[model samples]
Target chain A: MTPKKVIIADKMNQFSDHWNPRVIGELNGQQVRAVKLKGEFVWHDHDHEDELFLVIKGILKMEFRDRTETIYPGEFIIVPRKTEHRPVADEEVELLLFEPASTVNTGNVVDERTRTTLQKI
Target chain B: MTPKKVIIADKMNQFSDHWNPRVIGELNGQQVRAVKLKGEFVWHDHDHEDELFLVIKGILKMEFRDRTETIYPGEFIIVPRKTEHRPVADEEVELLLFEPASTVNTGNVVDERTRTTLQKI
Candidate 1:
């Protein structure tokens, strides 16, 4: 297989959807997905794998049930497995997420925010 | 446990060393490290886990035994497990690497290039 080098933002423009992550690359069986967020993400967590969220652009606020952390463009936060966290953005937010290939945005909870059909490129 | 937030670059000034990666955060069974590189990294690969390299400040060139790829700021590349690769930079480069917490920079092969005694913050 030819090695993949992903310029995530450049590939993200090909689609126009919020919350749905498009799988861009895989490493060590882990899938790298880029998601676009506008308003708020569902309060969810993956119980099997940890989720890594890197803010590509704009400010992102990750709100837990009690505490919240605001991430800037150059900042990133890792939501541990089973930690109920909701990501919110007052403005448009671009993010790069790393998790297992089977992980869903909302994990096993099926909802309007649950994106299971991940696109691979 | 107090949640850790790493402002990578802002903390890097506390130390001055190339190739030595500082353990910043860990999630699940993996750890997040930030390393400062100036010249060229050794031609080596981790046999156990894939290496994720994200360019934080300058350009980076990851050379493989067969092909090579250049990564610029905001770009990332994942070197698969056991894929012999080396990273080169003409100027100082700031990078963030994510892998298993037990992963050594040189991964079992201790040499002059290998940097051990990782600092935790």
Candidate 2:
């Protein structure tokens, strides 16, 4: 098997599109993805999957029904399964997402922003 | 449910022992752990699981049978299952480990340095 060492900064430079996640590495059944987030995302919930978001660059605001959490660089937030949440960013934010291989970007609601097939960077 | 957002740096500060892993968060079946590594570790292989090592504070050298990979902060390496590898750090190094809940720190080796029960910080 080939060796896999991912330089997070190098992978972030591979893509410039916002909200599109590019797979960086995979361990067990989970996929490690890097995404650029700007503006706001739709409110959705993953019925059976939990998503972990680790901020690498800018600030990320995860808005829930009751409250909002601000995640800075070197910080991570996990959105539990079946919980409705929306992610927003005032500026461009680089994030590393850890989730299962079967996760969809839009979760329960799949529209134009939904990315079913994620590209590996 | 309560919000779970982990500040990697803060969680890392809670531990001081080298080679011992502290759990930070859990997603799906995998547990995200933080460990401080110094000196040389035992050469072992996970026969049934793959482990991801993400450098957080210092340089970490992963020595394999064929070659050695140096992982710096903001970088990560994935050691495939059944691959013989040993980790070493010249000075104090902080690392974030991503692996299954049942994964043992020493892998196939059960030595005194092995941490069977990882504490959560």
Best by lDDT: 2
Candidate DockQ scores, in order: 0.52, 0.78
Candidate 1 residue lDDT tens string, B2-115: 144456667677777888888877766777788888897777777888888888888898888888899988788888888788789889888888777767787646679776
Residue-level lDDT tens digits of model 2 in B50-119: 9999999889999998888998999999998999999999999999999999999998999999888988
Give the TM-score of chain A, superposed on the true chain A, for all candidates in the order listed. Answer: 0.92, 0.97
Candidate 2, residue A21: Cα displacement in angstroms equals 0.5
With candidate 2 superimposed using the best TM-score fit, by how many Å does residue B32's alpha carbon deviate from the native? 0.4
RMSD of each: 2.0, 0.9
Candidate 2: fraction of native contacts reproduced: 0.74
- Per-residue lDDT tens digits for candidate 2, residues A23-121, read 999989899999999999999999999999999999999999998999999999989899999999999999999999999999999888999999987
Q: Any runs in candidate 1 off by more than 4 Å, and if so which?
A: B1-4
In angstroms, give how far residue B18 of model 1 lies from its true place.
Answer: 0.4
| RMSD (Cα, Å) of model 2 | 0.9
